[model samples]
Target chain A: MVAKTRGMKIVHSIEVLQHMLNRDERIGRTVGFVPTMGFLHEGHLALVEQARTQNDLVVMSIFVNPAQFGPGEDFEAYPRDIERDSRLAAEAGVDVLFMPTPEEMYPQDGGIRILPGPQATALCGASRPGHFDGVLKVILKLFNIVDPDRAYFGMKDAQQLAIIETFVRDYNLRTAIVRVPTVREPDGLAKSSRNVNLSEKEREEAPVIQQALQKGAALFHTGASAEQVEKEVAQYITEHSSGRIDYVSLLAYPELTTSSETSREWILACAVKFEKTRLIDNSILSVFSKEFPTQ
Target chain B: MVAKTRGMKIVHSIEVLQHMLNRDERIGRTVGFVPTMGFLHEGHLALVEQARTQNDLVVMSIFVNPAQFGPGEDFEAYPRDIERDSRLAAEAGVDVLFMPTPEEMYPQDGGIRILPGPQATALCGASRPGHFDGVLKVILKLFNIVDPDRAYFGMKDAQQLAIIETFVRDYNLRTAIVRVPTVREPDGLAKSSRNVNLSEKEREEAPVIQQALQKGAALFHTGASAEQVEKEVAQYITEHSSGRIDYVSLLAYPELTTSSETSREWILACAVKFEKTRLIDNSILSVFSKEFPTQ
Candidate 1:
């Protein structure tokens, strides 16, 4: 165990993390986990803050998962800064920061896979095929190793959160998934490590994602169809930003399914790709309410 | 919790089982798990006995997994004797018998899957496409639910055991996988619930599987190649039994790879198909040894 600032331990191997967690579990310490790809931002720090409040121990894993990236995707260009991440994690009161190498995490070709259901065919999953499978694969590995009492995910990636929620429930996993509201910049652009990759103009225009999702969600008050909401959101982003629209999806919340007449809750989500970055944002709303739902 | 004979509890719900185990875990009790498709033969009882001896708590789950059975297979006709199983489990000192219904186990279609690697392509896997995938899916669910310190599996399903071992290692699961030797009847037929499907004549001839494995393994003393061992085993079973052969495989142990000159440990395994039943057995041996390896 390597000691960081304020007696925080940084674990780089699975065996070491499990051993430490075993001791914590025996002592009845509730563990809360935050999984990230390093280059910590306010979004990740907010997750850590929530974890710090709920758990006796906070474990944060920073691994840039290769499997989650596709053939031409930015697996290589994904931002990583361990020194800065460690310092921020330490200041945020994380107990253990697990930083495992790709080789350490995936030592051999694992024949086993955790496939996403039809829930994966929309939003970001639609554009990046097999992305959720890779997300689930790494998450399952991290969950098995950490055995957290509760794990934290941001609602910025609403589709990812919904898929993971389904995965935990379907597998009967013990860990409770807590969804933290998305953290955004002063201008309403969702805070992400990739935000650093955005050019000045791209960053200035990125808040259009949140604005469009809110506008699309407001359409439901006029009893608009899901297709209308999607089209409205897509057109708004197209008019506002130089980014290419990956998708504009409005589906039943949590279930990530096409909404029917009886469906009460829905998620209006969108993803936009600029030259060097892809940004996603979402708004969850209940049609019963006249006003747009709170983040 | 439903109380059975001698204060043994039978839990039908995942939530209830987890609740009970949580208390047990808080007090630092070690849990031993034995997952089986129920029919409480000596083989399963032997696994229970081992669990009883090793851990403070013994949990045995008896659910005939529907996923593992291929199309037109005997999933519907598979043996089930819950009353007898419960009685035998209690008598053999099983602490908790988890008998969840198919509905309880599989409440919805789980999007997640655990696929096996190249190791699944030969032996019984050759004939049963998608069999190991199903095996891994259910086992992963059970493992997450039980969270045992040590899980027991019989060597009778050597290929399955090998696949599961790889899964556990590949995933870095905390549970220690305990390999229990195959239990046999006095006639040397490996004990299996499927054995009940055999006719009297088939039952009498099933011992040929073990005999054939032994013969093939002994030929390794003559520096026989894997093909030669496979051929010898296949010929012996054909000559001795009225059953048709499924496969006679000679592969590296645990790794389950096709053996080469550098391979020291080998698994000589075979499956025989009768009119109604398919029986599998294997013997693990070291080529460096002059005599056949023990069961």
Candidate 2:
């Protein structure tokens, strides 16, 4: 046996991790998992914290999935600081840090993928054609490898979290999901790895993405039309930030499907391209007619 | 607690089944599962035999999955004899029989599914679109519900077995798959659920499907070209049986992909349209070169 790093074991291969997990499972020790791309931040650590609180063991997987990135996407230039990530994860009380090579994860021609249904393919999937397919596929792989009782995801990517919830419900998977609130900087910028790519000026401008969503959400509570609120959110982000607006969508929360019913949850989601870095943020708003008063 | 039926317990809800499984798992009892569409025959019981020998507990789920059947297909008319199946299962040493209502299994819409890649969509999947999607989706649900150490599938549906094997491998699922050899009749007819739809004459003629594949295998071993083997197989089945040939295909085995390499494994598969019913059979061949001279 090797010396543990700060009471945390760093496993390189899936086989080693699974073997370790099998022993944990045999002893009936509950496992909680936090899956993330490398370059860990507070948002990712929030998920780890939730997992750490709930289970006997906490496993964090750092894999920059190539399948999720499209051509001209940042797969090549995606930030990688494995040593830093390891240190942070260890500090955050992660028990096992799983780091698998892409070749080991994907032995075949990467053809084996989980195709998302209409809900998963609505917002983010619309822009990135097969993005959720890769996300769901990788999550399935991670869940199998870790055999965690509960897995954590930050609500920063509410759409991704929703898709994963839907997949679990659909497949009747054993792994339960715990959605952690998004971790944000004091300036209100949602923590993301892509933030490192931001210029100093862009960093100051980034919080407007969330502010615009909040603006739309406030209007939504005041009984503004979806189209009107969407227009205002888009205009607000475009006007306040140096970033070009990718989209500011007002979608039904969780379902993400369009519904004429005003008595459902909603999300004001936005994406922006600030120089070389693209960032996404969203706010979940309960605008059910009974919950909010008309202006 | 309900009195056990012949030392076997039958469960109707997933909640109850999972509770029982959780209790059993706590005691370190290894579960073996055999998922099947009802109207249990020797073929299904053969799977149970394999399961019984290997595991401390055997669970046989009899669910005639509605999602798997197409609009024009026999979803409504599919043979189901739950009482007979239960009796047969008990006789075959099944410890638990899980039979869930469609509403419970698919509470929402039947839209949730596991889609297959190119390999699953090749031969049988081509003829029946979304069939394997439904097949895979149900199996995934069952796997989660059962959480079995091992699961069994008959080799009669080699394509289904292959697709499922790929899914298990790709997802790194906990359950290991046991590929049981096809249970055949004395006359060489592969047992299938659709066999009940066969007329007496059709039954006699159905064995030719297997015989034709064997003939093709013989010809293939004798250094006949793919064209020659395929033509002879199709011709032999057509001439000997009242059934019209649906497709008589010779393809590389396991991978099911095209290969010029003669050293690899191969499968001579055929599907025949017997009046209203379609039956399939295959023969695995290993013909690398002209190493063996004709007698």
Best by lDDT: 1
In order, what lDDT does every prediction score?
0.86, 0.84
What is the iRMSD in Å for candidate 1? 2.2
Q: Which stretches of candidate 2 lie over 4 Å from their true place?
A: A1-3, A23-26, A260-263, A288-295, B1-3, B23-27, B110-112, B260-263, B287-295
Worst 10 residues of 2 chain A by lDDT: A286-295
Per-candidate TM-score against the hidden true structure: 0.95, 0.95
Instruction: Give the DockQ of candidate 1.
Output: 0.61
TM-score of chain B of each: 0.94, 0.93
Error of 2 at A276 (Å): 0.5
Predicted candidate 2 versus true structure: per-residue lDDT over A104-143, tens digit per residue: 8887641456777777666677788878877888998899
> Per-residue alpha-carbon lDDT of model 1 for A12-93, expressed as tens digits?
9888788788743547678899999999999999999999999988999999999999999999899988899999999999
For this target, which candidate reaches the highest DockQ against the unseen true structure? Answer: 1
Worst 10 residues of 1 chain A by lDDT: A286-295
lDDT of 2 by residue, B1-295 (tens): 3226799999988888998988325466788999999898889999999999999999999999998998899888889898888899999999999999898789865143567887776668778998988888889889989888999999888888878888888888889999898899999999888899999999988888888888888888888777788899999998998988777777776666655354366777888897778888888777567542221
- Model 1 spans with C-alpha error above 4 angstroms: A23-26, A260-263, A289-295, B23-26, B260-263, B289-295
Model 1 Cα shift for residue A4 (angstroms) = 2.3
